[model samples]
Target: MVSLSDYLILSSIIFCIGLAGIFINRTNIITLLMCVELILVAVNTNFIAFSHFLGNEAGQIFVFFILTVAAAEVAIGLAILTLLFRVRGSIDVDVTNSLKG
Candidate 1:
């Protein structure tokens, strides 16, 4: 039987991995977006685990809200990235140092 601590530890590990990916993959915008999703997944894992352990529905409800928000966030982020790519022909973060119109 898995305990709450076990779930939390797993969540922590996943969260750290997401953070590392975001920090290390500094070149590609798509990869950064994926890392952000990964971080959200880690948060969802914690929410579900806590909901199960506490025998409450609030956590699950919050998880659904997070999921919806995350989806919208991804969509908007991709759209912006698409526009940036079309305008600049690249999604490299270093290129954004100069805001040219």
Candidate 2:
């Protein structure tokens, strides 16, 4: 049986790792996207774990919504990144900041 505390701890660790990635990698848009995905995955893990622990379906339902939002976020984010790359000729967010039409 999976312990709720262990699940929560794992979620926390994953979230921290994602945060670190975001802070440490400030160049590539792809790396930022990956970090965001990791954070979302951590949230999903917590939601499912809590749902199971509390014997409630609401948490799982919320997780579904979160997943949907994450997907939408990634799609829109990637589209924007593509546009940025097209305009700047590079995928580095730091360099893309100087680009203006």
Candidate 3:
């Protein structure tokens, strides 16, 4: 039987890895978005794990909602990134500081 602690640990580890990637790579919007997705996935994994362990359907339903929002976030974020790349001719997040008013 998979324990709740085990699932939480796994999810935490995955989330940390994604965070590390986001911090280490200061540029590349696509990579950043991918890492964000990874973190979101990790969160969803935890939700599912807890739902299963506690025998509650609420967590699973929350996970579905999270997934739906993540999908929308990715879609919009990518579209913006695409537009930025087209205008700036680069996808470096570090260069975003130049957008200051």
User: What's the TM-score of every candidate structure?
Assistant: 0.93, 0.92, 0.91
List model 1 lDDT by residue over 1-39, tens digit each.
999999999999989999999888868889899989889
Candidate 2 stretches with Cα past 4 Å from truth are 99-101
Report the number of the highest-lDDT candidate. 1
Candidate 1 vs candidate 2, lDDT winner: 1
Task: Write model 3 residue lDDT over 20-93, tens digit each, in one string.
Answer: 99999886878888889989989999999989988999999999899999999999998998898888888897
Task: lDDT for model 2, please.
Answer: 0.91
Candidate of highest TM-score: 1
Candidate 2 lDDT, tens digit per residue, 13-95? Answer: 99999999999997788999999999998999999999998999999999999999999999999999888878788898688
TM-score of model 1 (CA atoms): 0.93
Query: What is the full ranking by lDDT, best candidate first?
Result: 1, 2, 3
Residue 18 of model 1 has an lDDT of: 92
Go through the candidates in order and give the C-alpha RMSD of each one to the true structure. Answer: 2.2, 2.4, 1.5
